[model samples]
Target chain A: MSTGDFIFTGLGHAYLKDNWIFRNYRGEAVRGQVLALLGPNGSGKTTLLKILLGALTPSEGSVNIQGQVAFVPQLFQVAFDYTALDMVLMGRAKKVGLFSQPTPADEEAAINALERMGIGHMAYRPFHEMSGGQRQLVIFARALVAEADILILDEPTSALDLKNQNGILEWIDRLARRENLTVIFSTHHPHHAYAVADQALLMLGENDFESGPVGDVLTEKNLLQLYGLPLKRLTFDYEDLNVETLVPVFRNCKRRKAN
Target chain B: MTEKTVKQEKFSACSSGRFRRWLPKTPLARPWILGLILLIAIIGSLFMGAYPIPWHRILEILLNSVWPFSGSESAYLDLREITVVTLIRPPRILVAVLAGIALGMSGTALQGMMRNPLVGPDLVGVTSGAAFGAVLAMWLGFLYTPVILVLSTIGGIAAMLGTMALARVVGGRNDSLPLILAGFFIGAFFLAGVGLLIYLENPFYPKGQRTGNIIYWLLGTFRGAGPVKAWTIAVPTIVGGTVLMGLRWRLNLLSLGDLDASSLGINLNRLRWILITVVSLMVAGQVAVSGVVGWVGLIIPHAARMLVGPDHRRLIPASAMLGGLFVLGLDNFTRTVIWSEVPVGVLSAIFGTPLICFLFWKTKTKGWNE
Candidate 1:
């Protein structure tokens, strides 16, 4: 197998002396591949994402990526009420000269990106006013305008509703497949990862990680170990298509059949 | 590589994109229209003040000065009228306009860099530091215009460095709270330093004719406006403001906060410091020329933002023009309409405080977002 455009070997980080958040993390994501990061709260998932985006340096190890990188943070409110077009146009930040503004062609590219995302109608609408799912799409359009071959997202669907979550998930798959983009994302929902990810990195604890193909890494055992809750990886038929998903055993629910 | 990619991505009828004009929707919001208004105001302001020079005569004086042929035919014009029109009023007017532009542009840049509308040169400790430098220059008996200007710029940069250091110590870029506190701390410290210098100077030079200069610099006014003073402020504002305008578009990206902007391939520290240095130069020059003119720097940008919205490409030029106009108008009001020789600084604070209060009250209606 060929080594991918993105590779991080023996990655580690610590905010304080002798207090590593995580260490000895090694991973690589190739073209058109989707990698999902699964970890409990404070398991250095966001920190790892930052390291890949080059926003922060790991305490020990280095990351090397061959192509452009675009980071889609959580659906956030900007300080100013910039239009969706304005937000997307800023993706040309690299092409824009130090002493020059974005030209008309650059603006056209931004508009085309919005249209490609199927949100061309609301290009002039304020970004802060957009729905959560739409905002994620807008950011995806931004990554496209940036010509990013690597997309790093942190909890892209966290603040979104269930329908919006599906919308985001579909786009994530479509962008990876159609554009041949390397996509790395973190999520609380393992089913979302199981449905989409080719490779899974289960960050169970500091220096303790299980990573490989989804078939190997995303097991009921890893799910239980990762969340400290009884989880079932169930397979069933739904509307003539075979389906596989993870469901956790609840604390109060009487339905213990999955467990 | 970029050129290759550009051609490969086939364009699909994106003819309706809003790049026709970058100005705000309203006619009054246009920077050029406001610039024209400022020109008319500048010409109109020449007719104001204690020595009333008529419009036609002032026009003749101005035209003759520039177009030598007009003055020869217009020898009927009084020499005193020519002097007042061409010499005295123009210098003061230029000084006021330049200072205003400096304040406005500086405020807008500061706000954009900090990603908070509340930030200005004064709030960031630049104005006070520059003021202290100018006062110190006077205390040391160095009245050289360039020396005062240079020292003031150095002082402003020093103060900005202090503010940044303090901000980092407390909290980093994601929060604007620490920046505000640091600015306030450094500004107050510099103001005290200026006060001590003045107190120390008076004992040695009791009959030194320095009190008037002290009051002028501290309170801010056109009392000392002259050709030299105008140049002291003009050079920096024109040069620095141009650089600021040229780089204004980057502010939109920078406003996305530290982590986000950095991820976008911006060298956050380098870009931020460059912008900060330019802002310090302009603000310091204003203080060197006209003293620490208070509320114009702190508040005029808000009025500009109201007219132009938050896009820095439009906002920077709009603020600069709007600032110059505001300063010229304020100076005219105090110089002609008001009975007292009220310092423009005092008047600006008087006018500016209410506007800030109004802005504060407006936040409730606008909903907290920043």
Candidate 2:
């Protein structure tokens, strides 16, 4: 199994018709390896995740995503007012019998996942009313509950406090070391990539990209070229809480202020 | 080996804890209570009607019909007793039960699969489509018993397919909002078409003939329905509903959204189409028999979910039983509560709205999605 390779060759995926959301895109994700898909907003990071999850097939090129993959979508909105526990137990859908309802064992599995994330007390609370950070933790618990070897997450930590960011990062590192689960997640925070991941894939263009060890690939030069800006690395008494800063290249382009 | 296994094991334990929180202990008690209520509702539906039969005789007829020779000679059961038990009561009871269950399961499946609380068979356009189909058949003078049933069934299936196709074209996938919007447009189109058809028939056929026929069909009645009609509707209704029930867990996964559902190896596209078609077909059969009783599709599923929690495994079956009981109980009230027979469709719509609204109002502290 160690020698077994899961690779994508000449994979190009695009969005559906009339939706300018995603254009032709070539990318690759390796098994048993962390590849951080980074780009500006609307760079198709989530689109690529969707293609990998087989939610949408690529318009061009083939993908060789072996084994079952678990996905944690960026936006998680449940239809009903379910408890945090209900959200997590859904992860075991593939494992439970198709007809069989969630048994006592399945419920126990969901609860265990929540407890590991330290949100066990929030298990009974309504999912929609939770704070952003709390929701992120619950979503992570759902992804982990699947027990899938390949995990795909879209923007794993877009909304979280500093403490939760660090706490979740610590848990993720533990997961990679102990579980050997192939984790593929997208995030705007490069620090999260540097802190936990070994490899990074920067989406340089629709068809052009770069992938290598995080430190080597995420150099000052690489950051400048990707964002088209000269980013200043700041150091405080402690480490920078967020990723190393990448100033927008087109700062005076006026889009930054509007956002 | 130990470290990694333990990390995975730690998370596994966390998930187990989540399950404990989500799957409420009260759900186990729900099915039994619902079953008792259903038994009571059925007996009530059987006993209370316009023409009064002694409860003892009704029970005796029910027994003698099945067991035979329970009492011979002066047990003295006449043709009227046989007619009431076999012809009148049995078919009506079965229709009410089957239609209710069908609509209930259909609503639960649609709501769960679509990830929308407001969605059900009517919102999906199955009922309207089926109604149009039945109306078209009747317009063509296919009013004889067997022919009407068959034509109604066909109409229902056709309408269901048409609505689904339109929803897909507009919505891209099995998205709830778009599908619902499409249903609205399609329903409006069909409703107008039916109105036009009725107007056309009025001049061509006898003045009162076309008027009463279309009105009764539109209002969706269980009056004058028989066993043969029950069997026709029951077979497909139960079969399709059973298939939906079998896929209950997958349906729950689907409600979380397509991307999340597929990642769990659900083959989302196939399941989406299969469910859309099956539920449509099931609802079509129910509508063909009972016209287009509205809220049974919308309200019963939610009430059942509220009773048993939203786990489709329990939710679907409970919805079916309770839906049947609900419709039967309502129809019985319509029959005996007043001297004249009321349209069950109107009664369901009028009755269901307040109850659903009240439930929503009481739970207003929580938003639509929890």
Candidate 3:
């Protein structure tokens, strides 16, 4: 079963006839790989993500998915005041019987998932009361307990602060590299893609897309074309370590240091 | 983490996973302990009516009615007190308890399914439809039979179907607002029909002749509770409550909205309809047996959430017990404390609307403390 973990080609969707959101999109994800999707707002990144998650079907193409796929939606609020443990335990929905309550074994597994996320101490705490980072990690713990082979995250770290963003990126890397789970996340950050992604897909237009290794695909020229904003590959040394980061060089910034 | 200490945890321990939340967290409010308290409250209520009866005489009356025993306590039992406790109080208390349980359970299931805190069974128009059906049956001269109850159940289901179909015509299946608005209109329509039927039944007569019976029933009092009425409400509540309680965990997921729940490999359509049908059936039973006991279906679930913290496994049972207590307390207030009988449904609306206002103010100002 090694003909690429999954592949989709010529995928396109439109809410109305001839009003295509994105088209001619194709990508392949393998096990132990993190694929990042980059696009501007209204570029149908969410639509493409929905297609990959099998929640929505592409009008023109097909996604051949393999293994159990677990989806971690973007930061959200629950209507009820469910506890953190209760939130994680809902991951067992696929495992628990229709008429049966969750047994001690299931409860133990949920607790372990929370513990693995390092938020076990907040098990009994209300979910809505938790911070955005805590909630995102709780969703990650839910995905882990579901025993998913593929993880689809929709802008997982877009709403978090810088620290939580990096924390989420680290977990995404770890889940793919160590857990051997294929991850595909959609975000607006090109640097996030450069930092963690093996391959990047940029949806430029309805029929235009760029896909390749992160190095070749996330070039300054290509990102500038994709976002209509120039992004430079800046190199700097931090703590005696050679590092590179992408920064958008906005044209509106004041050129002179002092007036 | 917020200092919301659950007063319902000891009772919450009767459950499994979250039930254990009570054992290590809070050390009181066990199920049997609460059950004992409920029993005492119920027995204490029996002695509360205008015609007072002592506890021992009440027990003797119950025993002599059920048990063929040679006891000297029968000598002390008076006919009037025995009639008050056995014939009158038992059925009234039974109806109140069963209706409360039904309303509470239905409210929890509904709130979980709708994923909105403001949702209630009465909001969906099923109660008014059932009320119309009962009134229609009474108008057709089947006032003292089970026909009204049967028609009431059918009417509730029919009204819900109409609400759905109307919503489908307008908003399709995905939007939640159409369904709610459709329920509001359909419920109002049926309530108007109920009013028309009542007026048509006795146009020239004054209020008290035949209209008094219809008007009293419409106000929803337990003044005429009997074995027949109590059993009618009990059958659907027990059956539907069992099905709903079993689905508590699934409801926690279903309430996560359509997208994530579908990702979880659950069939949302089948689950949603099952919940609707069962909730409609239980509400229909309450409305049929005791005319539209208004706010228990709206109020009890929120109160239970404050106590049990929104885990449906604990919330369902806790709301149910609280429901019975709330309605029973209201009935006691009207029957004993007041010189004249006030309707339970009316009393519940008076209490429920204020609670809603308080909740709105609290949630609005605090923002769920996010």
Candidate 4:
């Protein structure tokens, strides 16, 4: 099956009655590609994500989504002790009838998704009792079980440790390539985007944004302008491996004199 | 394929050992057990009453009433005994069961929708609003049962809408604290209205009639439940309960919060309103028949959640049956244990409060942290 794509033309959104948060934003996320959205705090990344998910109607412009989309939020708080499998099974809500329970086929799909995410052992564990990273993995499993053409995640790796962050990023990349799924995710780290993203959409502000391949859009200059902080790129070569890392340069230091 | 088989084996291996011994093997078994207990409770209730009737005689009266040709040799079955069994006792017990189911299902729905275990019809002002409407009907001399049912149903919907509006005004959408706070004020407001109606009793009527109606409205009892009242409560409860049960899976998604639910193809606002209306109707039906019975809606759903996990498909039915059993048992206690009949509401609170407290203590350490 061919993957699906989302094309947005002149998209805009406003909070409250008419106060515009972002306007005239345009981008296209192609099928079988990972689009990384980068923005500072209060930069309307979530609002843009909401517009794509059809949770909010944009005031100006239109978006064409090719197929069904699933979202994995940053965190999920379950007030009751639903097992991890039960939580993943909810992804089949669109497929299940209104009054019907999840069938064995659905359960098998959920279990397969969890196993794909390498969390099959956690299927019977209570979702609320699992650690934060494990819970996030289960949520990813939910999105995988949905089998949506487009997967949208809002800061999926923000709360995770370094290892978990890499694990989730690797899964996103693998899912995009192997399953031919369209993936759009927002993150605070530019290096993460560089590591796995095929394309980048940088939200500068209303009427000012950048969207292109990761190689062109995630430069040191663009990264510096995005967060207004000095950054230095360092390359390490050990044996047959070469790694490039971005480090923030702290230039100004003024020691307080003791009274 | 190899990995898939290994994973499948691990899945069953993980599930098989962790299944609790106390819990039933499947979701279906728990409901059957609850149904059996409810049947036992109903029969036991039939046996223990002010009038001491033998179990065999009760069965004979029930069968003879159902089929006239099934005649017993004993002609000593008095009309009083037959009437008491067929007419008086059954209706009251049925009313209790219906009210319990309504309250229990509504509680489960509201708690799931709100994503808070502590919420119920009474806490959210639906019961109080219905109580006020019933009391108003009584004071206005419009004491017809259907009138009370309609007015109370409207009152409950109004109260629920008012709470939503107030929550919007106080905090942004999808804020639980503001909704609970709004419910608190609305409950107090309707309660005050009920109290005012009690204060302004009609002098043309006997003092006992006015005071007695007020007592029934404030502290719920199934005392005067007849076949008409029982059936009146049954229709709405059945309809509303069915709708709630059908929306059980949706409720599970809703408890995941608005953003997550919307992403899963659920129309969050529409689902929320439908749930609120269904819950209001159930609460109103129960309040119309039995005045503002507390704690059944709150405690029974929690108990059911503990028995069966948070899957609402199982939770809703379990809660409804357990609710029926709970109120039926309590009503029996009220009728048989005391020299004078005590309000079932008072008894429910006496039992429900400690259980809720224990649940609060139990679930406090888990579940709340994000």
Q: Best-fitting candidate, measured by lDDT?
A: 1
Per-prediction DockQ comes to 0.43, 0.44, 0.48, 0.45
lDDT (tens digit, per residue) of candidate 2 on B215-286? 886898898788777986788787887788778877778887766777776667788777877776777677
lDDT of 1 by residue, B54-124 (tens): 77887888888888786665868989998888789888999999898999998988888888777789888
DockQ-based class of model 4: acceptable
**Model 2 alpha-carbon drift over 4 Å, by segment:** A1-5, A14-32, A96-126, A129-131, A234-259, B1-29, B66-78, B144-154, B157-177, B202-211
lDDT against the true structure, per candidate, is 0.85, 0.74, 0.81, 0.84
State the fnat of candidate 4 relative to the true structure.
0.56
The TM-score measured for candidate 3 stands at 0.89
TM-score of each: 0.94, 0.85, 0.89, 0.91
Instruction: List the pairs of residues colliding in candidate 4.
Output: none
lDDT of 3 by residue, A40-137 (tens): 99999888988888888788987897887888888577878777888888888889988788888888998999998888877777788788888988
Ranking by lDDT: 1, 4, 3, 2
Runs in model 4 deviating more than 4 A are A1-3, A16-19, A234-245, A252-259, B1-29, B54-56, B66-73, B172-175, B202-208, B367-370
What are the per-candidate TM-scores when only chain A is compared?
0.96, 0.80, 0.95, 0.92
Candidate 3 wrong stretches, greater than 4 Å: A2-4, A234-244, A256-259, B1-32, B50-55, B73-81, B140-146, B158-183, B202-211, B358-369
Q: Write one digit per residue (lDDT tens) for candidate 4, span A1-259.
A: 2348888988888886667777777788778999999999999999899989988888889999998899988767776778888899999989987767677788889989999888887777778778778887898789888888999989988998899898888889988998788999999988888878889998987778888998788877887888898766768997898976677655564653546
Find the 10 residues in a row with the least total lDDT in model 2 chain B: B12-21
